[model samples]
Target: MKVPVKVDGRELTLSNLNKVLYPDYGFSKAEVIDYYTRVAPVLLPHLRGRPLTVKRYPNGVNGQFFFEKNTPEHTPAWVRRANLPAPGSTKNRERIDFAIVDDLPTLVYYANLAALELHVPQWRVDEDGEALKPDTLVFDLDPGAPATIVECCEVALMLREVLQVEGLTARPKTSGNKGMQLYADWDCREEPSVYAKRLAQFLEKERPKQIVSVMTKKARPGKVFIDWSQNNPAKTTVAPYSLRARELPTVSTPLTWEEVEGCERPEDLVFTAPDVLARVEKRGDLFGRA
Candidate 1:
C-alpha cells in the first residue's frame, strides 16, 4: 500500500502487514494501519477532511494523560480528530468500552475462554445482560502502582472475578506495556459514539479516586492521577502505547514494568510512521480481522 501523506517534507511508507503501527500513538504498526483502515474510514467521514494533530509519546509516565507532538504538524492539519470517550457524553463510559473487533482473527482470540480478560472491550454495558452469552469480550485493568507482571496479572484475575460476579465472562491480555486489558464476548448493536461518557462514569464509580487526573498543564513529579472522569466527552486521555517526550531515546519511549523504574521522561513521544507499526503485532491485533 502506498500513502502520500507526509508529516513535513518526509514521505511515509505503508506496510501491508497484519501489524499495528504508531505504537507511539498507542497503536502498533499494523494497528496504525488498522486504524487507518478500520476505524479511520468511519472516522474520516465524521472528520469531514479536516487535518489532524496526533499526540505522540517518547518517554515515562506516572500515569495521567501526557503527550507531545514531536514533529512538525501536517500543513493545515485535520481540524477535527476522533477523541476518546469523556464523561456526561452519555449515561456512562460503559458503552464505549464494550464493543469488540468484528474481524475473524480477533474473534478467535476472544473465543479463548482463558484470554478474554486481556482482549478487553472498550465500553462497560448494563443493557440487558443479553450481551453476556458473549460472542464478545473485553478486559480492563486499573494500574495502581509499580508492580510485577504477576501482580498485574493478579489484578487481571480480580477483574475477571468482577465480571463473573456481574454475570459477564471475559479473557485478559498483558497489554505488553503496563496494565492488562480484558475482553468479553457479546452481540452488541450499540454505536461507538456514546462510549467515552459511559466509560468515564463507570470508571468514576468503580475505582477510588486517583491522586492524579489528566494533566491540564505540566505536572510536578511523583504525583499521578487515577481519575477516570477525564475520559468524558470534550476530555480525553492519551491512548496506551502513545509516547511521551523523554530526554533519552531508548529511555524516552514507554516501556513494560521491568523498565519503568530506570526510565527517563521529559516531554512526550512524537508520532511517526515507524512508531505507528510497532504497536500492531505487539498487541496481536491482527489475530482477528476486525
Candidate 2:
C-alpha cells in the first residue's frame, strides 16, 4: 500500500513501509505521517519552508514518479518527475519522507531525528565540507574501506593537485567521518548545474580509469570517486558541521583515527552514537568546510 504526502504544495506518493517496503520497516500510514510531523518542526523552519517533495514507499523504491492521488491538478510542470525515486532507502520503502533543508544544522538535525523516529539502522553520508559551499568545486574521495589516515590524506593531496591545475578552487576537509571531501570554487561558473556538468566532464576526461560523476552505490570507493553531482543546484549534500546522517541508535559521530584503530573493522562505526556535542562545540569552524 502507498499513501499521499505533500510538501510545500508538491505532492508525492509515499510508500507505506509496512505495506510496501520491507517487513522489518513496516508501519502504518498514520505512524509514518506522525514521523514527518515531528521532524518537520526541526527543519522546515530552517529551510524557510521551500516547496518540497517526498516519495514514501512501502518497500524498496522502484523509481520516482507522480504518485497520482495526492498530486494537485495544478502542480507545477517543473516538478514533473522531480527526482528518480530514492533508490537505497531502507529495505522498507514506504516508511520515509524526504525533507528540504537550507542549512547544515537542519540537515544533520533532521537526519538524526528521522532515524530516531523510525528506529531503523542508517548510514552516514560522509559529505565533504567543501561540497557544502556554492563557491567551490569539491572532489569527494570516498574509500568504502577502513584505510589509514595517512593513506586518506595522501589521496586528498593527490586529488587536490588535480583540481588546482584545472583551475578549480579545491580545498580538502576530513568529511569528519571517513574519506574526504575536496571542494573546488569556480570563479568561472555561478550556476550549480553548469558546475556539475563541467566538473563531471572534467573528471571523465582527466580520470577515466577511476569512477567519476556517480551517486549512491554506483560510486562507492575502492578506487577514487569524484562527485560533482552535489554541485547540482537542485540537490544538497550534508556538511561537516552538519551531523553525520544517522538513523536511530546510530549517529555518524566523529571519531579519531585512534578510535578507528581500536575497532575490528569498519563495521564498528555503524552502531556508534557518541555524545559529540563536546567535539562539535570545540570545533567552531567545522561548519565552514574545514
Candidate 3:
C-alpha cells in the first residue's frame, strides 16, 4: 500500500508504512519516515551539498542489504542530484549521479525505503562539479579483540590532546555500534585524505602499541585502529543522527568531551531514534560546529 505524505508543501508517495524494519524493537517504516522528518532540520545541514550513498535494507535489518550510489531512476524530479566523476577516476570518466538529500521530502523518501544508514563523503560538490576541500576530518576508532569503546575513548582523549596542541578541536560521537568516532574541522588547504594519513602516521609513531594506522586485521589485536582511510574522497561515514542497521534502532549520536571521558562502556552512549529526537530538542546539533 502507498500513501501520499506532504512535507514542506511537497507531496511524496511512501509505501510499506506498516512494514516492520526493526523486528526487535518493532519499528515500522512509518516510524522511520517520521524520525527522518523530525530530524531533517538538523540532519539536512550535514548532508547538504554532499553526495549521499544510501545503504538500503528493504527486507528490514535482518535481510540482505545493498549500497546505492547512483540516484534511482524512479526518484522524484524535485529531488536534487549531483553528477560528478567517480573519485580516483580520470576527469570526465565514469560519472555517477548521486542523490543529494537537501530537503525534507528527499529524506523522508529515503527513510520510507528502509535506507536506514545514510553515508556521505567528507567533501562537497560545487556548482561546477568540482569537489570542494573537506571541512571535517574523521578518525574511526575501531577496537580490536578484547577492546571496547572505553579503549577507543582513551585513544580519542589522547587524540584530542594531540589535536589541541595543534589548535584544533575534536568532537566525539558514538559509532552507533561497538566503536567511537572523533571529528575535527579543517581549515587548511591540504586534502582531507592526505592530512588524515599524516596525522594517523604521527599518532601511530607516537604510540605504536596502542594505536595502529595500518588497515590490517592481524595488527589490530589489543589496540584501536585509527581508520584514517575514511578521509578519502571516495569514502563516506555514517551521518550524524542516521539510524544503524542493527537489531535495534540505534542512532549515531554526538557526544560532549565530558561524556566521552565519562563513558564506561558503549551502551552508556548509545541513543535510539526517539532518544536522538529528544536530544535534538534539548541540545540541538552537537556536531553543528563540524
Please identify model 2 stretches exceeding 4 Å from their true place: 1-136, 144-153, 165-179, 184-221, 244-275
Clashing residue pairs found in predicted model 3: none
Error of 3 at 145 (Å): 2.2
Looking at candidate 3, the ten consecutive residues that score lowest on lDDT are 84-93
TM-score of 3: 0.95
Query: Which candidate model has the greater TM-score, 1 or 3?
Result: 3
Instruction: Kindly provide the TM-score of model 2 when superposed on the true structure, using C-alpha atoms.
Output: 0.41
Candidate 3 backbone clash number = 0
Q: TM-scores, in order shown?
A: 0.33, 0.41, 0.95
- Whole-model Cα lDDT per candidate? 0.31, 0.39, 0.87
lDDT for position 33 in model 1: 38
Ranking of all predicted structures according to lDDT, beginning with the best and ending with the worst: 3, 2, 1
